[model samples]
Target: MGGTVTLRRALLATTAATVLAFLPNTAQAAVSYPDPQPITGQQIIHDPTVVRLKSGGYVAYSTGGVIGARLSKDLKHWDDAGNAFAEPPSWWYEYNDTGDPWAPDISYRDGTYWLYYAVSSWGTNHSAIGVATSPSGRPGTWTDHGKVFTSEKTDTWNAIDPAIIKTDGRLWMTFGSYWTGIRMVQLDRTTGKAVQGATVHHLATRPDAPYAVEGPYIVKHGRYYYLFASYDQCCAGVNSTYKIRVGRSTSVTGPYVDSTGKPLLEGGGDLLLEGHGRYIGTGGESVFRAKGHDWLAYHYYDADDEGTPKLGLNQLHWKENGWPIAL
Candidate 1:
């Protein structure tokens, strides 16, 4: 009887071990993504905005003279779709076109693809925002809407990086950089232009902070309008201190507060992401939802090289309290 009991006990122990080996660990399943690879159609693809095409593919547009579409069936391993905007629209160059086309925020609205762009001559106040419409986001077809807005030296700020958000049955644009932080103005729904007599409000500012804040991207989620912008100096190679910061408010107009309950217009921004390892100054951010998950696409100066900026993407996870964290 004792020998039989010993054998049974050993068999039970063996069975437990086998079951444990086959069981999946809950911790390892939480974080899983394919190893990241550099996006195609290079030459500083900064401030990337991605969207899903009607046929179920993805296209991304960014800064520089670098406006090209990428064909991504699964949001990974992209193929170049060639140049989306070959030249600055005549209306834009009629005034000034010195800065090499900065951020391009493309969105589908009113049965058309709207492409909002920025132009400037380096640090001068000649900066302006312009718009172009295309039947599709593909290359070789774009109609210029002329200059939408411009800045003067007296304004004490440069106008660039225009992000359009339609809220409450009306359209609004948020844009600015360096000299005066980020600002927003209401736009006419019919013409898609800034509404006259609409007051532009100071959204966020951090001049005294290490770097200036730019790249204003607004997304409405769960009854809150989240304002995302890049803080600090970007594109300084290894010396770049750029990072993404965010604030949110229930009302679209005023009083955006950070995680600390401090107003962003008063220089309070909750830090979202910064450089890590060979990546430096991960700024120029645009957020998108894909495959039932939110993702952030931005650019960073590569650590492997000295001064080249490359595209970087990471999934954005939100907490129960409604703040976004990069996963």
Candidate 2:
């Protein structure tokens, strides 16, 4: 889910690269590597989920009114295709006054392209996660499937920030934000909705007051299932403390742990990305596997651009030791 950005924070932090030198705790876990890989095509998006087109191109969808969409044939040149919704769905108005969908997720299921998004207002847990289907994976072709799950302000956990992955021949969705942490439930393969018989499992959380962890994206690699998420404060523009973290477990419904063997439920995670130089608040991410490489898709606030959030992609390289590193 997109966090609320404060206009004032954008004014406070100018050189994100400089502040990391003083984040003592992150020193042991966060990568210190420079962002040397070239990223081309300037465009703006948030919580973007990307799927490669059959034509060897890539299409991305993200959170916004009618859902912002973009396409790229070669990763170097980007074209704003338009919003995924030709007109705002009537259902979204129940949760979001502006009809802006958040944290859109895309995946291929059988012969269909499935997109899942959150219809929710900022700072409130009153929300709904809706599903849509597209035959060609294009913007206007999508048919909204209505609500998959809904959470109220009285619920124990906020339901938002959805990521769906097919593992062990079953589809599972993990979602939550700023409530009781990350939660997962099984989805009916036929309907792509939560299986009524399956139990909801609480996956990860931060025990502190605000418990600032959310945006769960899981990927199975080798024998382990890696869980990635955002941690700390977000949406504060340049002062956004959002960063990506990872934990792993042998089971999909996990007891995931970080590099230090601490359980994710206890706030354990190995830092992946944080603000550095102009790349501020790098989180709300998704992973896509193609060409023998895993690509991380997310958003970052560009300090040079007055903290405007934009899309980001980087290759994940697994070290000989089996840990993933952004190279």
Candidate 3:
């Protein structure tokens, strides 16, 4: 009787362990991500922010070459349209010696196209976010508007990867990098620069040191404001660990939390999309609306094509629970 009881107990323990092995964890669970939509032509880009133009078609602005530009008629086959500026703005040299700009955000507002971009040396917190205006959302039409915001080495937040949104009739820009994660500041409606004496608001950060979250792009869907950000190391080609994560809050300035009710500041973000198969290091994401649907635009390191960072686009779907799923 004792031997039979021991055997039964051991069998139950083994079955329990097997079931536990298949359970999901926050960071390492096996979640299959869909591949990016097929794209062709000049696909190489980094930190892409796409916007549908008022005139026609689509344009993408990204890091490198005085805010590199790519134009597409159908959002499928992209063509390199050269740098947005003929030369780097004179003031951009104050932060970076080369005047090399990075991670531009472009949007059309009130009959004018606004361009916000960053200038900073690699691995430094001394940075500046600059704004420009374009009569037409074309490569060479942008007129530099000088620095909209800046951050020094003494600051906890690194000012880069600028993303803009308007809510409650006020303009706000969310920007940050590795130092303290994502942050936000109110902008002047007319000038499009950070308001004088504006209170800088903390948005998201990892609990651990060297907090890796950055590239914050917020979109209001239904009743919740969804904050999309890239997490982990980037620009290392195939070895990069970059992936996209998200959290949502009712307020524009959030105590944003993941689907599990964990705060983003506490390293709580639901994994929206990540590297899988040949598309390695998928990150640097932004959202845009076109054809009556929301679309996600980002860049991914293509392992099959020498790990070149290229454009990745996917349709975003909202679940019944109001969470976003990238299809």
Best lDDT goes to which candidate?
3
* Distance from true location, Cα of 1 in model 2, Å: 41
Show model 1 residue runs off by greater than 4 Å. 1-44, 94-99, 207-211
For residues 1-327, could you state the per-residue lDDT of candidate 3 as single tens digits? 979986875575445434433443342235457688778899999999999998899999999888899999999899999999999878888888999998999988899999999999999999999999998889999998899999998999988999999998999999999898999999999999999998889889998878999999999999899999999989999999999999999999999999789999899998988999999998999999998989999999999998999999987867646777766
Question: What's the TM-score of every candidate structure?
Answer: 0.84, 0.89, 0.91
TM-score for candidate 3: 0.91
Residue range 1-327, candidate 1, lDDT tens digits: 979986875575445434433433222123322222334544356678888766577878877563655567776566666666676565566445443577888888888888888877666767788887888766567777866777877886667889989878889889988876889988777676777777878888874742288999998889899999998887688899988888999988768998678889778877777877787888888988788978888888887887587777776656656776665
lDDT for 207 (candidate 2) = 72
Clash pairs for candidate 1:
211-232
lDDT score of residue 111 within candidate 3: 94
lDDT score for candidate 3 against the true structure: 0.89
lDDT against the true structure, per candidate, is: 0.74, 0.82, 0.89
Off by more than 4 A, model 3: 1-31
lDDT of 2 at 85: 84
Worst 10 residues of 2 by lDDT: 8-17
Which model scores highest in TM-score?
3
**Clashing pairs in model 3, backbone N/Cα/C closer than 3 A:** none
For candidate 1, the C-alpha RMSD (Å) to the true structure equals: 9.9
Root-mean-square deviation of candidate 3:
10.4
